[model samples]
Target: GGRGGLAALRDTWQPGPGPLAEAQAILADAGLPGRPKVWRNRLTQGNLQLRYGRDARWYRFTRSGTEWRMDGPPSASPVDLAY
Candidate 1:
């Protein structure tokens, strides 16, 4: 991502899915604890908050996460990993 430091990490952050229900499925299958919440975001076409606890609304999936592509190992979307 063009951004660096924490911004870069935030930009590349990717979770399971955008929808709350779908994201719950991903987290459940992976034995992870989190939830996805939708918010009105002008910066991004949409925003999904994936996390639990007080910071539950902080976790998000950025554009870089979607752009990620790999041919080696078992690289898959968070949703794919859940299954």
Candidate 2:
């Protein structure tokens, strides 16, 4: 069944588990890997902040609703997202 196949694919493609579990799941469904390292409070109203790291670089992200944008350069300090 087409619906069953879709559900199977969804289940198989889900992320294992980590810091940004929910966000990672959502991004995985959307074809992007989620790697949320830090959560910040930007001075802007109604904006959610996210910090992610990959390879050896960190990135600051700003999320407005479902949309996301990069805010700054990678962090110089090492962050452990597993916490």
Candidate 3:
């Protein structure tokens, strides 16, 4: 329902080591290696998407065609949702 959310965030999103970068680093530290396409607080690699919540947690999402659906519960560590 909120496909444009990321785009809307672009104006306020800064280019630096924030949640997106932290999540990437977490995955790498956990030995799950792969760089995802990032935009603001969201990252996408293949059909999997990782979104950072305002609550300082990470949420996993899976894509089906053009829609992205939440796959499971949120985690404080991105590594927990790396799978």
Candidate 4:
């Protein structure tokens, strides 16, 4: 019931489709091709990935082989990450 417990709970919790739909809309508006696959807070399309941060920012990632690594800093808009 302390900080550790809260962290564990946050880790296990999955955000609903609101974030995912918002990201999709943003990408679509930006004219990005294809749709991203959602898992937890991440959206992956091809080698590009975007993660919704707890800080209300979208983070960019790139897939290298089987691992996805952070590619840049976080932004308040998913459009920035999509580009």
Identify the leading candidate in terms of TM-score: 4
Clash totals, every prediction? 0, 0, 0, 0
Write the residue-wise lDDT of candidate 1 on 44-76 in tens digits: 222233321122232333334655222122212
- lDDT of candidates 1 onward, in order: 0.33, 0.34, 0.67, 0.69
Candidate 2's C-alpha runs over 4 A off are 1-46, 78-83
Residue pairs clashing, model 2: none
lDDT per residue as tens, model 3, 20-66:
78777666555444557787777777677877765566677788899
> How many Å off is the CA of 35 in candidate 2?
17
Candidate 2: tens digits of C-alpha lDDT, residues 1-83: 13332232223222224534444343334433333232321112234333333222333445656865655444433131111
For candidate 1, the lDDT comes to: 0.33
Which sections of candidate 1 miss by over 4 Å? Answer: 2-18, 33-76, 80-83
Candidate 1 residue-wise lDDT at 74:
22
- Worst lDDT run of 10 residues, candidate 2, spans 36-45
TM-score of 3: 0.68
